[model samples]
Target: MDKAKHFERSQDTAHDQACDPGRRALLTRAAAMSAASAMLGAGGWTALPAWAADTAKPAAAGEAAVRQGVWRDQKRLRDVPWRLRLPAGEKPVALVVFSHGLGGSLDGGTEWAQAWADAGIATLHLQHAGSDRAIWSGGLAAVKAAASAEQLIDRGHDVQFAVEQLLQLQKSGDAAWARVRPDALGMSGHSFGAQTTLAVAGRDFQMRSAPDLSESRFKAFAAFSPSAGHFPGGIKGITRPMLCLTGSLDGNPLGQERDGRYRRAVYDTLPAGAKALLWLEGADHMTFGGGGERGAGFGQRLLGRERDGAPEKLAAHHAAVIKTITTDWWRWRLLEDEGAIARLKAPKGLNADDEWLQG
Candidate 1:
């Protein structure tokens, strides 16, 4: 599918009138990103403040839930094409911004974004120009040239730019972007996108020439199939709530961990407690992208093949796993739903093949 057009169609859909100023203010304050000092507390359930603990509470059994809506527009963010998925009602909710992996389009993590939107959270899909699927424009040659210290920094700023743009919309009271709950924002990425997530979540690099990419706006992070950068400096323990998703076999031949421990490596560096890790059994690089022939052969050739014996058959089940984990997790972080945090602590609802481990 023409990735650019895919984003265009996303904005073409009908949008429901969103939250009023009063409701938007309430949701934003309730979900605002916590201070770094607050995050430093022991990194476990016990560290959560009374209000944070209160946010973790679940809804009554018989209560009706909110539905979600989607809006797409290629020009919404200028050069950065995007798709916004929001909750259906006029009440405000949490919002998450997702970055696509290398050689991936905005829809790469569609299933997860859909899951968030379905549960009354908003999701903004970001398509970074330099490192996105467009890198494969001329096949392998372009693909080989895709990764660099430069583009990675650009990817990180793209997210900041998106957030800044929304802040502007909030000021203008624009019908679409303005409705986002001001303080209830989270960030996530897949593969190369995971590297971007690391950059935004306070991970600095060796190059001084690059822009200061650590963004305070994104209060939490979720990285899928994250890769190590070539430059020198690295990540220390991140303080915010984080969920690292990786598979036993999810390694890139071009990455530092040839044995597929890259995901765990990133997970290891995050502060514990508000942090969790999901290591799906038999998952691979392509599984997170919904499984199929991907890349322009550059990725396939350089990395050979990063897949299991029955990757196609396992794709659907893995999709469900991502959906369940992300939906419940955002509920914990954004809504302050105590029950969602409990669900994440145990994660018994996922497939038996999955392992839910925490810091």
Candidate 2:
């Protein structure tokens, strides 16, 4: 199949699952399970037997300070909805702007954002106008149509514009905005949002006459389930530190490249400086989206359970490992913490079969 057509079909499937009420309910249950499994007390979160219990501390004041708003780019006539999650304090912290997948909204990536905030990092979740949940409202045709190259470029613009706006807000002395470390900004996303992250991180989409969409402000990147087919221009200009997170079962559902290992191209094609790849053994695409083992429901429903039931413990372990490694990445790249860098060199909370490679 043509890569573009395959990408479109893949996105269509993503939209279908993301919009499914059953999937949504399952995701919610999975999230609740993740939270419940991690929170043992005020001391710290529950870690896998391989990791210490104090590996992840609770959020400051028991929760993050969330601020929500809509910012309009008058030049492009674009309205970007954003949600900022800050650690519960006035100190300046590293900020990572998160982009959601197709048909996703600012509500996406909350699990990662919350974990980062708890670890004293901030997240700015951006919702692009042309490719958000609004597409699902128009039905499957609109959903499929929303997965366009133009929309992909627009998402990059959304990230740039949102970051620019954040800089301006910081200059304006907004207390919450002031807490963001402008010099330590990072970019991250899941699925199509992962494509957006790479675009801003310097990957090109081979768009004709397209101005450079890569934003130099992002110091590092963390892409979850990034699409290799969406950006055929490959890793020409991307040179910053990046961490690719994917799963062994993280396959393209509606495309020819059904094997999840294909997603590793994003990590494999990079120039190899300050780059890392975390390949979870049993995690699927939605696992990075916060569904854990339940995220593999599509395959489970199709091929029957792996053992007559989901391994709830493994699900929690995946969530814990993601939070642990990603939080450490932010600390290392954004905060320049030597301890974090050391931890990333040999991260804990992984099963024996998981792969953590860096170069």
Each prediction's total of clashing residue pairs, residues at least 3 apart in sequence or on different chains, is 11, 0
lDDT of 1 by residue, 1-359 (tens): 33222212211100101112222332332233233225544341221111111111122443223222222212222266666666656567788888887677766677677677678888877787767777666665555455544455457656776776666656676455566887778888877677777778876443233346677877678877764432213555467777888887776634344334645666676656677888887777766653322441237555465444755677777788788888888887877889887887787656677788877
What's the distance in Å from true for residue 39, model 2?
Answer: 54
Worst 10 residues of 2 by lDDT: 45-54
Cand. 2 Cα-lDDT: 0.70
In angstroms, the error of model 2 at 250 is 0.6
C-alpha RMSD (angstroms) for model 1: 14.8
Alpha-carbon local distance difference test for all models? 0.60, 0.70
lDDT of 2 by residue, 76-108 (tens): 555777878888877898999998876677777
